[model samples]
Target: MPPLFKHPNFVHFWIGQIASSFAFQMLSVGIGWQMYDLTNSPMALGLVGLCQFLPQLLLTLVVGHVADRYNRRLICVCTRFTMAMTVGILAYGNITDSISANMIYLCAALLGTARAFEMPANQAILPNLIPNELLSRAVSAIASAREISVIAGPALGGLIYLIGPTTLYLSSMSCFLVSCVIMFFLHYNFTVKTKSPISMEHLFGGLRFIRGNKVILGSVSLDMFAVLLGGATALLPIVAKDILHTEAWGLGLLRCSPAVGALLMSIYLARRPLTHSVGKIMFAAVAVFGVATILFGLSENLILSMIALVLLGSSDMISVVIRSTLVQLETPDDMRGRVSAANSVFIGSSNQLGEFESGVTAAWFGVVPAIIVGGVGTIAVVGLWMYLFPNLLKRDTLEQ
Candidate 1:
């Protein structure tokens, strides 16, 4: 057995992550497709991203502090349960033919709130599951799990969407419930001993830590800006409907294309991890991601678009594995939660907020132009970041 699978806690964590991630991906497809169907406006889709991201933006500090102070496992379990219920609401509403665009916005907000807590806690707990030597591979393994969901969830959701939105919502809700139960049984030693009463310093500790650590800050920010600019996934529905002239199933395949590339890259990295020039490799991967995004934006053929997405995911997996391992290995365990929380903000900003950006830009400049511009912006950020964070560019390995 692989070292990661041998650890029972890690296995449970892995399975739980898969379930939750799968549910979320399906929820995304369901909500996004439904939102677009109801309003037929690109701006409404943008609002979906905005509503989901606002909670995370507001709760970053409190979330970090809570993760650091409270029991992380409990936090994770409760968050999953909350998400299950949130989706359950959607399922009920859809089944009764009472759902609306506003309801989706509200659910997006609730789902975002749950994820704001869940993401950082999950990131913090991984180090506790295995020795430091295996951290890189573990990160890759987790990414592979997520990629599998990304590949499967959307395709399945797209197929299931043909049945009914209610069915998709119920399926997603059940997945979230399963994840909650699995995480409830997950065991971990919470040795964090922060007794300092609520103070500004404690709340902002994660941000401060990242600011002080140039490599960590640079790596996280690089991803934030690059993806923030190059987030083409947000416009997949528009692309599939108008450009590719396809339906829900085609959208599902379009959504999963990147994951297919990401899954393959992640599996390879897990088996044979990066050994040297890790910093250079990550930058190169981001550059490739930018180029792929441009290709995707320009492609009208479904096959060509899928190929571009595959490249995007493959390159992105390299960057994710490198950045995740770097941040976790560099931070002290006691501070992991807080630091991971701050890191999650960067991730949330890049993904959720980036979707909003893409939507707004697509509305303003047209979908293809917005995507192409974002891709160009991503490449520009990479060049600028290399100049700004020379330490990250020069860093030799993931090991502290």
Candidate 2:
């Protein structure tokens, strides 16, 4: 067995992460495809991302505090259970022929709330499970596992969707429920007894820490801007239906192409983790991501598009690993939850908010133009960030 997997707590946590991540990916495919199908409007699809992000924006102040002071594992379990129920509600609505776009929006908001709590707690839990020596590998393992789900979830969701939306929802619900059960068995040795009362200062401590740390700030903000500008995943449904003239299964393949690249890169990193020139590597990866996005935007052929997506995903995995490991290693354990929550804000902005941006741009400029412009913008951000944050640009190693 791999030395990392020998840690039982980490093993259980890893399993739960896979289950929940798989569920979320399937849910995303279902929601994106369904919303686009119903409204045939780019704006409605954008609103789905908006709904999910609003909760994260609202909860950022409180989520990290809760994760630090409370039981992170319990928080994970509760969030998974909440997601199970929320998806079940979605399934019920579908079965009853009462599922509206608005209903999906509401469910999305609820799921986002659950995710807001789950992410920080889940991230904070990692350092507690394994030794410091294993931290990078742990992060790599989890990212790789997530890529596996990313690879499978959409494809499976697309296939099962042929069976029906209701069936897909039910399948996602089952995965969340299973995650809840798996997390219940995860045990780690830690006790939280709020040392300080909640105050405005305490709530924003993570942000303060990030602000003082230029490396963390630069790394995270770079990712935020690059992804915010470059994110094309949100427009796959449009590309599949209108541009590519493909069906649900084709959309699934389109969605998973990046993950296929990410999965292969993640596995390689797991075996030979980045030990030097980490910062430059990360910036280069983001640059590649930008280029790949542009390639994807310009390509009309499905195979060419998939190839572009694969390169995009591979580049993204490098950034994800370097950024994640740097954040976790830099923050003290007591501060990890809040710091992770703050990190989540950046991540959420890049992903969910990026979707909104993509939708708005697509609506105004047309889908193809929106993607191309975003790709160019991403490349611009990389060049600008390199000039702006030289400390980040000069960073040579992941080790602090």
Candidate 3:
């Protein structure tokens, strides 16, 4: 058997994530479409991001603590079930023609709550599934799967939305249910070790640890600032409707363009694998991402926009793989959950909070201006991060 498929747990987890990711992409596009259909406001779309992420921020510490204290697989199963139920409720509302913006908001909030627990569990469990030697490849493969989902899911969602929002919700619910079943087969003997009693002291220990680890902190900080400044995903609806003059199907294609680029690149990386010079490569890729974002912001033509988004996706994937590999390699087993939680907070904030920033900026400055400014800001952030973390830039491998 190929090394990638050697571990049943890895196979199951990858397949399950692909299925769930595809559904998630659909749900994401569907939600944006539904929100725009209801309110036609950029700020309203941003509000969706806010509703989803607020719970993640609120529950990050608690979830991290609990993940370390319980069976990771069980936590995953319960959270998947919760998400399934949430999707079902959303489906019911859509089918009954009773779907309101407020109802969607409530559903989003509940999903966020579930995710608060799910994210940390998912990150902390991966190292246990694959050997350390294969960690980089595993992360790359996972990135590829996500990229594939990004490519396929939104397009599917856009097509389904043409049929009706109910179809999208129903499909998403089915995906979630499948994920739950797949998770049931994840056999791992991860037991929480007994430690000192829970207290504020222990909680602060994780923070202190992260603070001391400059490599992890630097990589994560670079990602956070870059995504925060350059993320234009929240403004995609506006671009699809007003700037590009595209229909639902076109919107779907536009959404998937970046993922398609990322997917292709991920396949290449998985085959060749970069074991050294990851730091320099990551910085360059992020810089390219900024450039792509800038071009995307300037382009009104559909083809040009698609090309730009693809470039953006490809570049972003490189950074993601490198950063994730660093985190996995540097973190010890006992501290994995807490560190993963911090990573989640950084990533979740960069994405969701970035969405909020995009919406608010778009509301004030118009869509084009918002995206352009974001791209430029991202480039500036890259420069600043590189300057601040000279030691990180010089480091060649996580083995250090």
For model 1, the stretches where C-alpha displacement exceeds 4 angstroms are 32-45, 94-103, 161-166, 235-253, 297-302, 352-373
lDDT of 3 by residue, 161-234 (tens): 89888888888989988988998889888865987799976665556677888888888888888899888977
lDDT (Cα, tens digit) per residue for candidate 2, span 139-201: 889988998887778778888888989999999999999999999988877685658878999
Relative to the true structure, how large is the alpha-carbon lDDT of every model?
Answer: 0.89, 0.89, 0.85
Q: Tell me the TM-score of each prediction against the true structure.
A: 0.88, 0.88, 0.88
TM-score of 2: 0.88
Q: In candidate 2, which residue ranges exceed 4 Å CA deviation?
A: 29-46, 91-103, 161-167, 235-252, 356-373
How far in Å is the alpha carbon of 177 misplaced in model 3? 1.9
Per-residue alpha-carbon lDDT of candidate 1 for residues 1-400, written as tens digits (9 for 90 to 100): 8776888888898898999999999999999999999999979987898888888889988888778888889999999999999999898888888999989999999998998888788888889888887889889898998888877787799899999999999899899999999988888887759487889988888889999999999999988888899989989999999999999889978977888999999999988888888889989999999999999999989999999999999999899899999999999877788899888878876787788799999999999999999999999989999999999999887895
Scored against the true structure, residue 356 in model 2 reaches a CA lDDT of: 77
